[model samples]
Target: MGVGVRVGVFLPAAGFPGMDHGEVLAAAVEAAVAAERAGFDDVWIAEHHFMSYGMCPSAVTLAGYVLGRTERVTVGTAVSVLSTCHPVALAEQAALLDRVSGGRFRLGVGRGGPWVDLEVFGTGLDRYENGFEESLDVLLAALGRERVSAEGERFRFREVAMVPRPARPMLPVVAATSAGTVRLAAARGLPMLLGMHVGDAEKAAMVEEYTAAAGDLGGPEVAHVAAGVAYVADTTREAVAVMEETLPRWLGPGLSGYRPVDGRPYVPKDPVEYAGLLCRLHPVGSPGHCADTMLTTIERTGVRHLILLVEGAGDPALTIRNIARLGAEVLPKVRASA
Candidate 1:
């Protein structure tokens, strides 16, 4: 395990059964503020469009908002859906936030699902299926150099100077859920953001693949981030109970809302079963158990930075409390052992 295990919060801005978008977003901001106060290292915002699962449409915009609200913690998108966004425009926004936030902003981009977002954003289904690499290339170019142009199969443009250059050259963290994405990120010498749904073994496998693929680049060590659910209570039972009571109600509707643009047969996970799996996979227990679980994950995945999804309780106040406990109670133990 690494000498220091960095902890951060994942504010999904999840819209539970009865909550409105305003309330969801408010809870997210409150959680971010609470995580910072609790002494966590970062706050990562999740982006989802036109869904009750996650209400935030523009993660970069929300990241800017979170950055303005906190002074110390790093703020980033759990992922900004790259397939649905114009790479140059998103890079420009990332650079602006990086400049204003004093390099506290991290742009985490992913090839989002085959959803209606492509149609709504006017990027189309082909971009989601085949154009992500080109988009990523454009994004990297726009961020790496003062002037950029693209003459790719999907995008063609004349050169334009990057205005208001970032505090440093932007190196966005690419979200990797599959081999192709992992290889793409590794090829670019970019760090990866691994998803929460997988087990320790699976995450470790992804890390191994990334490490092998990234071996030849020989740059500074990449700080890969792992996302997981988090909850804390005096007893493991109490923590698990809370997650069981609330997570399914939130997950059921949210997971079912994704309309696959390719007309592929899509079967959403059974929310109750999924919630149980998350409880088993994540740190949903007493502080001691949570700390131990984190340590084990770190040892297995070789990933030192963790971004925990703290909204599993599906209540604003409880989510904030979870963040507080994670930072104040769980983080100390993890760090001490690390």
Candidate 2:
């Protein structure tokens, strides 16, 4: 590994103030293009339903689109909601994407949010846990074999085969965060994706758990890829200023009652505490500061892949510029430190 760490960009497929739905999607594409040109490793698209919070209800579709538009840049779903689709269809589409992209596709799956997704998908929160397990079984089976069957609690399929099989022998599956989901990923020898909200201590504990769970029989030890907001500016003050203005929109009431991965009871925080925690845990500062924060995280924990949440960092121009600065000013220093 040249740097022992890889940096990816988390494209915002969600709402933005003054930006229309079409523009947000287009901006995400532009951001991916810029990130690739800026030497970023991969692009992960998000999935949401029935809310402006995240406009991309189909991360797989967006992944396919991005794959078609870019060369050499790996495209993945930050998560494609398993609860929302027929697993066989999802596997076929994902495989086709991989085939077309010449094996540069990754599949990241998550049990989706509880609000509009649950309401629209007609899945009560009660079923989410079991549904996720069942859906995952179907997805994994479909991806690995020509024909598969699953008599899962919520889903049952017989002799289903994914057409246009994946070009590569194996496509990487990255599981997003949840309390017990890390172990779930490890048991299958798959990697896990973490989010910004997880504090440093929790990340260390999670990584330890994954390492222990993946002992001995490892094909690859857990690929712990974490994501957080990042923007590079001439000064920390400028970066913080931009974040303060745009964060309210990104963290708006749409996420109210959102249950954290640790299963902690949701508690409203004072603005000061929130802002303080944001700076303490995330990279929202000058290019040098950004490099320092990333290096610190890599040192503290074994996280090697970071998906910089740059979609809402600023306007389209600023977001693009942040990618360039991170690639030029920050990446070298951070990688060199390795």
What C-alpha lDDT values do all the predictions have?
0.90, 0.75
Reference-based TM-score of each model: 0.97, 0.90
Total clashing residue pairs per candidate? Answer: 0, 0
Residue 230 deviation, candidate 1, in Å?
Answer: 0.3
Residue pairs whose backbone atoms clash in candidate 1: none
Residue pairs whose backbone atoms clash in candidate 2 = none
Give lDDT tens digits, candidate 2, residues 42-150: 9999887655667787998988888888997889898888766777788888888888888888888877744445555676564465677777777788888978887
Top candidate when judged by TM-score against the true structure: 1
lDDT per residue (tens digit) for residues 39-127 in model 1: 89999999998888899999998999999999999999989998998899998999999999999998999999999788777889999
**Cα error of candidate 2 at position 71, Å:** 0.9
